[model samples]
Target chain A: MELKNLGEFNFIHSIESDTIYDPNTVVQGIGDDCAVYKVTEGYEQLVSTDTMVEGVHFSFQYMMPYDVGYRLMTANLSDIAAMGGIPRQVVLSVAAPGHIDTRILEEIYRGVKEQCQHYHVNLIGGDTVSIDGPMVWTITIIGEIPQGKAVLRSGAQPGDVVGVTNYIGYAATGLGSLSYNLDGYPMTRIGHQRPEPQIELGITLRELGVHSMNDISDGLSSELNEIAKSSRVSIIIDETLIPLHEETYKLAEALQTNPIDYALLGGEDFQLVFTAPKELSKALENLGSITLIGEVIEGEPVVQSVTKAKEIRLLEAKGYNHFHE
Target chain B: MELKNLGEFNFIHSIESDTIYDPNTVVQGIGDDCAVYKVTEGYEQLVSTDTMVEGVHFSFQYMMPYDVGYRLMTANLSDIAAMGGIPRQVVLSVAAPGHIDTRILEEIYRGVKEQCQHYHVNLIGGDTVSIDGPMVWTITIIGEIPQGKAVLRSGAQPGDVVGVTNYIGYAATGLGSLSYNLDGYPMTRIGHQRPEPQIELGITLRELGVHSMNDISDGLSSELNEIAKSSRVSIIIDETLIPLHEETYKLAEALQTNPIDYALLGGEDFQLVFTAPKELSKALENLGSITLIGEVIEGEPVVQSVTKAKEIRLLEAKGYNHFHE
Candidate 1:
């Protein structure tokens, strides 16, 4: 199935169902801040890793080592959030050129440690090797998802309402700011350099029984498609109902591109996209900041838009592909 | 401080110890073939990650993708073994160009899966992306170690005999064969291609009063230096007692390089270098095809000649350096 409309969580949830063995050991697998496994009876373990490279995944003009460190750490923490896990330790294996400053290396580690300490995750073991070209860093994170519980990405079914933790397309807007010259968008620079992972919301959602879930790294549509494929169900998203920040809308309007397209296809959002049964949906209504976007359906894999004139099919995959140009 | 001299297990152990928090649930940390944690009372989880790159770390000319897969998988398995853990699942991340063959990729994964099944590990999740040049593959291994009994590299004390599970310097010899035209050294080629990780020996050592230990990756001298640094003890080696394979010595003789130096300085020998008390050392006298290279001391690190009339001190800290051209 295509990755676009299904979204990151859905893709992960589908994969998680088939991958999780020794379920009793995996307190939670895929679809949360991180994958939570019980390391022992009383304590929990968190694991997440991210790969960042030049040209394909990122560009040199837009990224620095410290920024790389910050983003990589955030990616890992996002995994921890998806699992309702709290991070405690991390190991970084970074490959770069020999001439990169020892301080720059220190800065990368410092950024990583800063995030870890912020999340209460400690900086531990790592390997630093010099390479000739673009730099590549992979950080493996270990955290605790809490005892006796973990949030999975495969629990959503029909009659469940779809909800998102924050306004989508901000990171994408930030990307637009990087790729093209866009002005007047606040936090666009910060969003590109220092995207945040929603850890608290992930735990609350798990405790509140927010069914199937995932983080929005591969754009909103891609994540939804993943959940749909994994749960073997369909999702219907309201095109107009998707919440977009004024910055994102303004940027899209300036670029002459549809804001809905950016919301649907822009990646690196790192927000939570979850589904919950109708009965449990009310718990999230007034609980905090959230936006109700759509609902689950029982049919073929497709995200249909609900509108007055006609229901539009928006299920075609529309984000990044490693192999495709 | 450099990776080449740090050795794998010692580096990982340092990271594991410093990184983990509320590690009550961690059945096993670093020092094993994988990191094992209890997800629940009834089940356990394992996780590990290995990164391989071109030119600096490996050469495509001498190593096939299948062999790369084998070596990478073995590296991950070594982590699991160090923890006294069993492998359950693995996630592989690869960065390569689109033109790479599907069959080669399948064969690589086939080798990985074969080894996993052989060791009772599973192939679970991973990321794949295209890069500008050279293929870099990173695999994260998940495993299970028993509760309360994982080994540590920092557990060694003085008065312990330094033991090596098998012959050292083969992998480095093999690497030398590829680049230096070592026609006489048939074994060096094998060493470069398929170095074994002493998985069984690692698990067995955990029950043998073994103290500080690490894999002999960056030469015997380099690994010994790490054990000395970490356990805060000196290790004195009897130079004459060191083991040297016939082919390695033959090649070294042809090249005017001392076979002893090659054996001592060569890296990528994935055998276990560990310490045990005198009684346990004697018990290991005829255990298997192994080597009792030296003993842990109280004062300073030294490798002295036992046969020559005048004692010759071995060169200090002159092993492989990844950063050195």
Candidate 2:
């Protein structure tokens, strides 16, 4: 079951799919020298890339090669999702350490291919090189957004209702749990291994005419702060109203860190946070149970305390930055 | 300057250019997360990727970060060039060491952007991550070839003339100079550090209608051997006509290796080695000074010698395979 036993070609073969292809749209997919997608009407091309480095992004002992593939693929897919676009194809360039089994390499590709199949995206061409150190997997995904329908980080308006898709801080808690060698918290562990991307929900929100959007890869508070800075608006968050998974709270309590802080500044959640006009609130109501954390304000950045006791302004944004570490 | 010194935004900013956008076709190029190229009529899309790892593909002491960027970008561009296509855009992903200097990172991007401007490629979008070890830079380039005009490795026919652009083994020689700490050979060093992709020459050959083509990165003899195996034809290479750089011979003589062997088996030259039918030989006559090394034969894979010289069937491929070392 480990990647080391699954040969590369076999891994690729296992993930190949026979999806319905529109000849005019995609000239080639999985099997060719390159996956060719046609640039057609009503669509503007969107692309995003992510490279996951060993020891930095994930640990070899704790994470499976398949999990690494899944995580890396999801990272790119989330960018497309943030743009309210359907991912079409992915090109991968992987650099592996010498002496790593070819089977593990195959498993990594298998993981990548499986994710592409799940999202109905094609696995196109890529390059594989051997490295002198740890493995590095880089994926470039090409997507298509409907003309004039892109959801930008700078489009949030003041007075719009701030919304978040699901509980916050779980992924960070998951990462914390694994890194600290804490016992229990399987949910958090799963969250760390696979952060669910809010692709479908993002599309729905876009259709409902949401004001602006961004994925919460870094913690919710950090991402919200980004929106506020980019849109030049202030955002308030009802600390008590922010959702936290049951396991996340328990783990945070055990670690002596505020569960709210975890939810506020935790990273790699891949959840969508957006603001919508008052009129679109009704549409959102029918779509899902959206917890309104707060509303965008015309002034400076602030994340209000839900207890009404501590009205703290979360001015500093915290999340993941490659160099900041 | 090291990459750590160049802040991320500044790095991206330093590489921006106007050549990335062409009114003839592309809707967008570089900037805005991804480079978008409008698929023009009568053109087929081609894409290629290559990842170069530090300590594997390069060493910081021998080559500057800019040359790393230049070489990495050229590797993929050369693939596009080999396909006889115009490279329009590239996605670059880098996994930097956590403590890298920002200035050096900026130089890398600046080098990449310079190459993009020189080759007329747009820097679409890419991801950056911090790692625990040496830096890894990966580039994926998208190109366009005229429909039905792409020459494949398997298209060599019997009686076709084998031709190569420029001399071979210079890069290998240059690599020796750097690795062995030899005195200066700027041409050799430049040849090794920055490969001149035969983009224009490939386009010309494509227009002239060639049978088969490939970029010679995996050495002259190895690539020719691949063509023979894939095309199911034999080739007779004249040792006397094999073009070896003067520096290569000097380095080989010093190292006690055959210069002809270096030219035949060394890799990373990035020149185009191709085949054309006998009828098109006249048209290709004026295409620089190309040496007619051999002719395709009907029999099995074999490299015959001219003038009753000793024939070397085919040496094992001794090019750069990261895992082999």
Candidate 3:
């Protein structure tokens, strides 16, 4: 059935039926003007919003409705992870043409429900509106952390060691493989379609005394540049230490581009990039699959790369430009 | 300058400069992956999100960029007010065509900043993306109320008096005047263009022991119908007691329509419709410009209206349907 025929309230009721129950925090959900929740005492709140517009963020050619909803939730969850917080609730607003089938929206909501159940988050409240244009999804996530426990990008010190949770360039390579319909790159394809938010890894890092952190959403160079600029410290990464999946190299070779470039400039990795004191470097490494790739230095707010040939090269603090694209 | 030339980051930076300072509660704002805030120890958090799509909610023909931003914020704030909550922070996501001028966005942000400062709410983090279609603005508001003190629509008991803040029908008449370029309805035009959310009135009502409450964003009949359904009570409104502005009557006559119909089915009034016990009716009257227009009864969930001649008429729960519109 089309949305116009189903009407707005019935369509909303259908989606609300599958909301994850969270009685401990959510006082009211879905039906009220505002969703009320009890804030855990002695904890701070964290909020972040992200928007995905059709034709700009994704195309129907490469992504199904389920993928779009799942990825949007993943992106918002990654923001909470970057803050060392546990996500608790989300409000999603969607705008789509009236001619669309109701089942498509139901599938999207099902994807959202799957992610919320996986993360133990509650779907609190949101708005659904009709548009005359392409579909647009905007999600706002609310999370909580212990008071004064949030690790900000401004906390890194001059001599801190920079580390990342996983290999980079996989998501970018996944996009490339999907775009060209290349075979034999399941890891990259899954990476782009369903990137995982490092929520547990972030909390562990915070407990491990990581000074500063960010999620790698805008590629390695741009993420590093943000850390450096916010903390007012110079950062230099060793080219040999940067981890890239083997599939990334193959895809870059097929596309006639450098794998390092993809690792540096491609985005949507959703891995945690953080800094810790040198004394905690061994502890960080022992905790998980984290790689120490760089060091903070006392200088201007710039990011540099030490090439394999032992020469330092300046890296431009540029990433995916949405408007330009 | 077009947004394409300014790029996403710089456009964000331009708006970041106008954020209101809230050092007491906000630990971090705008720059990080997530905005961080300290929650009050004895309060519950309230969250609500609303979206406005270009050509669906508003058009440049009827609204300036400033009005669009201001109205969107008003809509989100009204949701919090309906729950007797104090709005504190907001996250706004905007998706627009790349060819739109940067000054227009700046003006919109300026209007947003004006409202934030007026309400003492801080601007938190959000996303800005380029869309190939119409402009869409989605705002999420985070608010707070004393623990277990929020007023829900399901709390109204039989024999409670239903009341409303100020006169209705003005907004619907205002829309008509604006659309037809009719003069002599300046009040209606301003009412439609810059509707105010009754935040203070809501808090006062909650303090005065009001049972149920809702903001009249979808006309009086629709709002009353929701309350009746949620509370499982019948509501009977007195047509003689329903307040209508003189300007509304004049405009309705000019358009050959009944002003009562406008009051019943026209939306975007942003007025408060609530219920209070009979003993508290005097207290509600003393509080401000509140009018008691109806009474709740133990019956099927339906709304009826009583004419001056003692004739009863069933009222349809019809209001603004986003998809149908």
- Give the fraction of reference interface contacts each candidate recovers: 0.17, 0.45, 0.91
| CAPRI-style class, candidate 3 | high
Which candidate leads the pack in TM-score?
3
Q: Chain B vs. true chain B: TM-score for each candidate? A: 0.80, 0.90, 0.97
Over A239-277, each residue of candidate 3 has an lDDT whose tens digit, in order, gives: 788889999889878989878887888899999999899
CAPRI-style class, candidate 1: incorrect
DockQ of each: 0.16, 0.39, 0.86
Q: Please, what is the whole-model Cα lDDT of each candidate in the order they appear?
A: 0.65, 0.74, 0.89
lDDT by residue for model 2 over B37-69, one digit each (tens)? Answer: 455566767776777778777778878888888
lDDT of 1 by residue, B22-113 (tens): 24445433321123344546544545456777777776688887777777787777766655555555556666556666556655666666
For candidate 3, what is the lDDT?
0.89
Where is model 2 chain A poorest over a 10-residue stretch in terms of lDDT? A2-11
Question: Which clashing pairs does model 3 show?
Answer: none
Winning model by DockQ: 3
Which runs in model 3 stand beyond 4 Å of their true positions?
Answer: none
How displaced is residue A265 in candidate 1, in Å? 0.8
Q: Once model 2 is optimally superposed onto the true structure by TM-score, how far is the C-alpha of residue A222 displaced, in angstroms?
A: 2.2
**TM-score of model 3, chain A?**
0.97
Model 1 ranges with Cα > 4 A deviation: A1-46, A146-149, A307-311, B1-49, B80-89, B142-151, B177-188, B301-310
